[model samples]
Target: MANSKWSHTALLVIDMQNDFILDDGLMRVDGGKAIVPNVIKTVERARQHGILVIWCDGGIYGEIFWLKVVREHDPQGRDVELFRRHLYSQGKVGPTSKGSPGAELVDGLVIKESDYKLVKTRFSAFFATHLHSFLQTAGIHSLVIAGVQTPNCIRQTVFDAVALDYQPVTVIVDATAAATPDIHLANIFDMRNVGVATLTLQEWCEADA
Candidate 1:
């Protein structure tokens, strides 16, 4: 791939944290383990093309006391999404808690010092985050996504990217996953219907050739 072809593009690696990709993680997505190799390769290809690589993980950083306070006050999870309300209410620390092992990126995926990192609390990387502003400031007009659990984070981020007018928002199919093959394909189909470019790792790597 040529650098100029993807110079304005950014690769958004969503929630490739240990919790979602490792087998023994608290919130492990079984299928996620299989995609690590593809994800790594995709990241490498993007880097070679000079595409900005942004690692977006599910982590909210703050003073320890503040986190405790928020969790206590919102014990019932009135502030969280409806689906996660029950889990949060039960005091589940969940994946990507501050300082947790699950919050780190999985093995084999490299995040060099030059790469950018964004921490998000919600499923969508854009929700309540400065991701949009950062991309805009960096002149990023397109996105290539690779990461885990297609049904939630992946889908939400892609939808938001489209809404934010990021054209040609591509999702590397084999570099992402869901709990099952059916779920993965279904979400991919939905993304494709919305004009999202759904490509396999190989196809995406060769897109600018």
Candidate 2:
């Protein structure tokens, strides 16, 4: 595994911001801040390999996403509408809210001026953003993904990348977390057994470059 061999690889840091990780943020994933060290390790490795690094953050204006979730979950008899209402009133996911300090990238994730920063309107970064085109332009054939909320953004992005014929490797240490350990563990299992290739921080760095 050598850096020179992975010039075409890229690293996608998904949704590791204050809003998703901080306690006061609207939707905080437990242990989100704790994963910073691991994410930093991955970012360093990607940079060392000359791999393009892209930061993907979710954004919303108004109650578009929350309202949709409420409708879908209510159909299943889930009590999500109340929470959705609260989130909406609290201004959680509305219009440039992601630019707030709480939604900014964590302290040490390493976003250099030369790196690319993309704001996504949905869970999957490729859905409504220029992520795919950016990768193609950079000749990126493989991706190393790390971010918050494993069951949401990280999982969606990895799945979407696979659907687009890109090899995706999700680093467990840098990827997902939920409100509880059980939920996080379950998500990791589901993702690994599905399409995404899951690895630890150390394993990912030492893997075939």
Best by lDDT: 1
Runs with alpha carbons beyond 4 Å of true place in candidate 2:
57-98, 173-175
- The TM-scores, one per candidate, come to 0.84, 0.76
Regions more than 4 Å wrong, model 1 = 57-93
Q: Alpha-carbon error at 3 in model 1, in Å?
A: 1.1
Per-residue lDDT tens digits of candidate 2, residues 1-209?
22556766666777777667676765677768778788777666666555556677311111100000101112222233343445444434531253356546667764544445576656677876677786676566777777676777777777788788886555455445666767777778877776677788878767753
TM-score of candidate 2 relative to the true fold: 0.76
- Cα RMSD for candidates in order: 6.8, 8.6
Q: What lDDT is obtained when candidate 1 is compared to the true structure? A: 0.73
Query: Candidate 1: minimum summed lDDT over ten consecutive residues — where?
Result: 63-72
Clashes of 2: 2
Candidate number achieving the greatest TM-score relative to the actual structure? 1
Clashes counted in candidate 1 amount to 0
lDDT of all predictions: 0.73, 0.60
Candidate 2 global lDDT:
0.60
The residue-by-residue lDDT of candidate 1 on 1-209, one tens digit each, is 33566667778878887877788887788899999999888766766666777777311111000000001113344556676656654667655666667777788875554455676767887888788887777677888888877998889989999998999899999999999999999999999999999999888867777
